[model samples]
Target: MPLKSIRVLDLTRLLPGPYCTMLLADFGAEVIKVEDPMMGDYARAYEPKTDEKSAFFHSLNRNKKSICLNLKSHEEKQYFLRLVEEADIVVESFRPGVMEKLGLDYQILRDINPGLIYCSITGFGQTGPYKDKPGHDINYISYAGLLNLMGERDGKPVVPAAQIADIGGGALPAAIGILLALIERGKSGRGQFVDISMLDGVLSWLQILLPGYLTNHIEPERGKQTLSGGLACYEVYQTKDDRWLSVGALEPKFWSNFCKTIGKEEFIPKLGEPIDQQDVMKYEIQKVIRRKTLKDWLEAFADKDACVSPVHTLHEVIASPQVSARQMLQNIPQQTNSLQQPGIPIKLSETPGKIRSQAPEHGEHTKQILSQFGVKEK
Candidate 1:
């Protein structure tokens, strides 16, 4: 309940912006989603539906209120501004000039409420050569040079299954920025604008590689980074049952323990070998791994000092004992069925978050939200 009185006017849809506000809303913020009148959030109609609601929409939009408003209309825009006067935050993911075109940019909002923490989650940010250019998660990652470090050696760069650029680069960073700005506002008594570009976020998270690259002009290829399958000790191997095992036995002690556990003590020192040149070590490890089922290896290493784990599929991840114990999944009751939603990960001893309600229906709280602000339905 740390954010119990903080009000957020969410003017975003899809993944990044909603996810950022979702983090806030989970912490007990009053998140009012001011969606487009015509389509609401496009995620509502996105595929993979359960009981006529998009699972995508259901997952990211819980613990929030929704109100469809035509920001393009003079009357509704005034209504939104009225709500903004009482809001502490406003999060949007529109293109650079879209809000300005509607006469509702950060400058306008800041004037109306100097204490408003306005955040813009864009692809390239508000002031860049690519600011006005349209792009998605794939384009942002590739432009930020993250795509080049994602595939097998000598193979084409692989697009990740998860939207790393969207979630990590955009959503998570936006959330962090908003929190930092909130802290700063308490000191200065004036809020600020947070410009979060996914491309910049991608580059910022790659700072670990910057020191070497800046000094030696080193350009790391796919599968060459120490943690990205560069060594035999840190790689994925297939088992006899075709399931995969992740081995992170990077420390010398763990590597030795893993080799000895597999009855291949001779392979203990081969962990330092490069997978591309001394790939025989990996090949031998793979062969040994292929001889056993995943369950067999799990039992063998149950009490061992090896850092080994099964590469869980979606179903296995949800059914995992650790996940259950940690309360990472919540089964929320919908109209006709229960939908399993991801639980809030931030655990606060005094103010822990909970799923207070499911995602709202389109414009479900329009009249109530507006009337609360003394702006009647016109």
Candidate 2:
């Protein structure tokens, strides 16, 4: 409801740009997705489909309109400019200079509407040596030195299950930048360019690791830091049933509480010992943890503040009590079946967001949108 009057013209496909606009659209902004007439969003063809619709596409593209337009064509490009005249934001995720080549970059858009917030979400950024380099989430994380600190002490870096670079680095930052730009526009009555690079985004999250290396000139080893895996107090231990339990009793008091609860009070003082000594302690803790099932540990620490929790699978996560209480899931009914989608996480007491509609089919609203803009599609 807060952004109900805002209009966004989204020219992004795949993950980052759509997700940024999806956040805006969920908050009651009018988002029109511009796609190529032939392919639309590339994610439409991705796997894990339900009733011929992409689950990945449906998750990021709800509460938005769609219109297929070939930016290469003179007529269609002119039509898009007409739409931009009334739009408050324009988001794109192409490689650098792609939009300029198509004559639809920010400079051209600003000529039509000077108050338009133009956001470019790219792999590197608009002005960098690697600006034109082709990359995905994994590549961005690797370049940012995040991948080096993710795996075991001597093992190779593992690909994360989460899209940290795409969603965290790219999408969320773009949304934040757009919001700040909008606020600034209200004061200055002028819009500016927002350049978001995924590499920069992923690297910015390395606050502790980067600072430690810079200050002490010591390279951090993987899985050897206090929080990564070196300490017995903060690590994942396997249960009797092969399920994992995350033990995060980092503080001395919590560590003592956990040790005493498990009838191992002697392990309390070894909380922040040296790395080799901590490994021995971790091995001992793992042996003790393996004696019980996850259910047993849950019951044992049910009333304690030891910061212990289960590492749930995808299915368990969806049915979790905390996720349910927070209302982080929604079921939207399609014509043939119901599609369960992720609910909006930004909860505002007065102006909460809603899933107004499902993702639009390719060019589903093309003619209607053109008609409303007084421009008939050729």
Candidate 3:
């Protein structure tokens, strides 16, 4: 209940913006999701529908109210300005100029209320050579050098299954920036603009790698670096049953312990060797791991010194004992009297985020929101 009375105008449609607002909403903010009057958020049409509503939409947009409006209309724009007068935050995920063209940019809103925390989520940024170029999560990751470091050494670059750039880089960082700006506003009595670029976020995530490249003159390649897939101590190997095991015994002591436990004690001395020598050690370790079933190997390292763990599939991940113990997953109840959705991630002793309501139907709160501004319902 930390943000019990704070209001956030969510003008973002897809993942990044919606996900960020969801975080704010979880912490007891009154988030009003403003969608297009006709199409609404495109996410509403995403697949795996239960009853003309998307499971994807429901998961990301819970604990928020929806108000559909035609921003192009002058009357609606005036009504939005009135909402801005009472709002603490206004988040939008459009290209740099789109909002400005619509006259809803930070400058205009700040003129009305100087304490508005306006966050703009984009691909490249507001100003840059590629700022205007259209990009999705994959393109942003590729531009940020993250995708270049993924995949097998000799194989094609593999795009990660998760939208790391979109969710991690853009959404989470934007949310953190908004919170920080809000904290700063307590003293300054003013708001500021937050420009969250997916490419910038991913590059920030590569802090160690970038510094190493710049200082040591080491041009790290895909699957050829220690943290990537090059090191024998840190790599994934397939077992006899086609299951995979992730080995992360990167520390010298852990590597020594792992080499000894796998019955390849002789390879302990070669742990710090070059790639060719490391490959010899890796081959022997792979052979040992391949000899056993994933389950057997899992038990063998259950309480051992080896930093070994079985790579779990999505189904296995949901049912994992660790996940259950952490209470990371919660079942959100549906407003349509259907099944529950997944719960919020972070846990807080005070002001924890909660799902107050299911994602609203398109424009479900439009009439109510308009009435708040003294506009008569159509």
Clashes of 3: 2
RMSD of 3: 1.4
Q: Candidate 3: lDDT over CA atoms?
A: 0.87
- Estimate the TM-score of every prediction: 0.98, 0.99, 0.96
lDDT of 3 by residue, 1-378 (tens): 877888999999889999999999988899999988889899999999866699899889888999977889988888889899999999999988999899999999999999999999999889889989998999998988888899988998998999998899999999999999999999999999999998999999998689899898878988878888888999888888989999999887888878777788887777678988877777887888899889988877777877898898878978988888866666766545564566778888876777777789888888888798787755
Give the per-residue lDDT digits (tens) of candidate 1, residues 272-300: 76556547888888999999999999999
Q: Which clashing pairs does model 3 show?
A: 26-353, 26-354
lDDT (CA) per prediction: 0.91, 0.93, 0.87
Model 2 accuracy (lDDT, Cα): 0.93
Name the best candidate (by TM-score): 2
Error of 2 at 50 (Å): 1.8
TM-score of 2: 0.99
Candidate 1: pairs in clash: none
What C-alpha RMSD separates each model from the true structure? 1.2, 0.9, 1.4
Badly placed stretches (over 4 Å) of model 2 are: none
Q: Which residue segments of model 3 deviate by more than 4 Å?
A: 335-340
lDDT order of candidates, best first?
A: 2, 1, 3
Better of 1 and 2 by lDDT: 2
